[model samples]
Target: MNPVIVIGVLSGLVFLLLVSGTSFKPFQFLGQGVIKILIGALFLFFLNAFGGQVGLHVPINLVTASIAGLLGIPGVAGLAVIQMVILV
Candidate 1:
């Protein structure tokens, strides 16, 4: 198992997985969720983008990220409500 051959094989497998749809559904969903949470976090940041107007700053962290990842948009809404009712 030469180093070059191992790397090439790994790359080829990754390429194949990327090219093939329905090959591994769970991984695809996980990948999408990871990207979604990151983007959602950014959206949360700017949710209160204004200095002092309509700014909803949901602290971006593991718990929030997990909530966003698992519950999607609803999770964000829930977080907002929770923040308002409790933290504020």
Candidate 2:
């Protein structure tokens, strides 16, 4: 087969796939999870920055980020409460 023919076929296949409306639920879920984790990390960063004044520091890790990401503000609040309760 000629190289140009092979390349054209591959490109055509790719274009067809793009127009096929394939369901990518898993990828969407994964992407959303990653976005949530990043948002969680940002939240924790700000929390540390401002909470430092009040001696409240929540470590930003995978677990914490997941919690904050999945559970939103309440999760961050819960972590803060746990920290204060345990350390104080």
Candidate 3:
């Protein structure tokens, strides 16, 4: 698929959505979820980077990311504990 065509289609969709004046609640929720997931991934990355010295690591995947994203720091702590328990 051509990048230009994809951009055009997306632009058209955005224009239609904007002109329709429809509720964006669903979109907002989805955007927030995506942002949270990205943040979760970042959290995992840093955990791995700094925690490596302590021999702590958590795999970054959909499940882990969702858990971290939805639950925040405590969620990451839970994952770390789980990993430690499994390792031991």
Candidate 4:
């Protein structure tokens, strides 16, 4: 998708890894990853819901950027899945 969204997803994934690197628990890391995905999904929903009237139509792109920027590829994928779930 948009570059910003890609960047956001990448960033998000990186942040997830960086933050989780310190945690000794594997489950905690997985949970953290899941949370990131959920956050991305929620962001997309809100963006889609009000982006048009609020002049935030590029919400998915924005969220992708944020997530990518924070988490990275995996995060982006998770976000994508969330989006798909919302769509279908």
Which predicted model would earn the best lDDT?
3
lDDT of 1 by residue, 1-88 (tens): 7999999999999988886866678898889888877877765665546423765567888778778767777887888888778898
Best by TM-score: 2
Error of 4 at 37 (Å): 1.1
Rank candidates, TM-score, best first.
Answer: 2, 3, 1, 4
lDDT of 2 by residue, 1-88 (tens): 8999999999999988876645676788899999999999988898899999999999999999999888999988998998899867
What are the lDDT figures for the candidates, one per model?
A: 0.76, 0.90, 0.91, 0.65
Show pairs that collide, candidate 2.
Answer: none
Question: What's the CA error at residue 41 for candidate 2, in Å?
Answer: 0.7
Question: Number of clashing residue pairs in every model?
Answer: 2, 0, 0, 28
Report clash pairs, candidate 1: 48-55, 48-56
What would the per-residue lDDT of candidate 4 be over residues 5-81, giving only the tens digit for each residue?
99999999999998887775888877787677667666666655754574433345555755844675566556556
Lowest lDDT block of 10, candidate 3: 19-28
List all candidate RMSDs to the true structure. Answer: 8.1, 5.1, 9.7, 19.2
lDDT of 4: 0.65
